[model samples]
Target: MDDATARTQLESMLAELDRSITVLRGDPDAPGDRSLADAGADLTDADRARAMLDVAARQRTAVLDALKRLDSGDYGRCVDCGKPVPEGRLAARPEASRCVQCQSVRERRR
Candidate 1:
């Protein structure tokens, strides 16, 4: 996708991830309540919320990183191999920093 289209999409994803992180972490704007300081440690099912919060935070970070890469003109390139990531993959996951082959290798190591 073009830079403008990619920026628009990435920005939209960033906004959604921000909202998800805020809600999952607990409303930071909530008055006299457990704000984002604890990262939703005070919520019911602390364990589950912790997992969800972690996922959301990771996603938010990925989206932010993608935006940064976009600014640097590296958004569509795989971080590991430095190859152009497939459009289909980017269409499905704009936050992806690695292409399928590199990503598979990393997952295997993990």
Candidate 2:
């Protein structure tokens, strides 16, 4: 995608994340309740919320990182290999800082 499209997507994702965080914060369910016999499902829900929050947090970080790159005039270069990240890859993952090969190698190491 183009920079405009990527920016739009990031904005939308950020707004969705904010809404999700608000919902999670307002949620009343808890993992522990002495009055309840089975808190398994509630705990699972809490876990799911936690996982979602983590994802949102990462997305936020990616947005910030992208913004920083934009400001630095280094938005499209691969961080790992100093290559220009292809438009197709950027379309797939606007937050990506590495080319596919570098990303694959990094993931393998991790």
Best by TM-score: 1
Per-residue lDDT of model 1, residues 1-110, tens digit only: 88898889989988887888777777546666456856556554567878998888888889899999999989999999999999999999988899999999999999
Candidate 1: residue 105 Cα off by (Å): 0.3
Residue 27 deviation, candidate 1, in Å? 6.2
Per-prediction CA RMSD (Å): 5.4, 2.9
Q: Pairing residues by index, what is the TM-score of model 1?
A: 0.81
Q: Using Cα atoms with residue i matched to residue i, what is each candidate's TM-score against the true structure? A: 0.81, 0.79
Best by lDDT: 1
The digit string of per-residue lDDT tens for model 2 on 55-82 reads 8788878877876776687887988788
In model 1, where is the ten-residue run with the lowest total lDDT?
37-46
For model 1, name the residue pairs that clash: none
Q: List candidate 2 stretches off by more than 4 Å.
A: 29-38
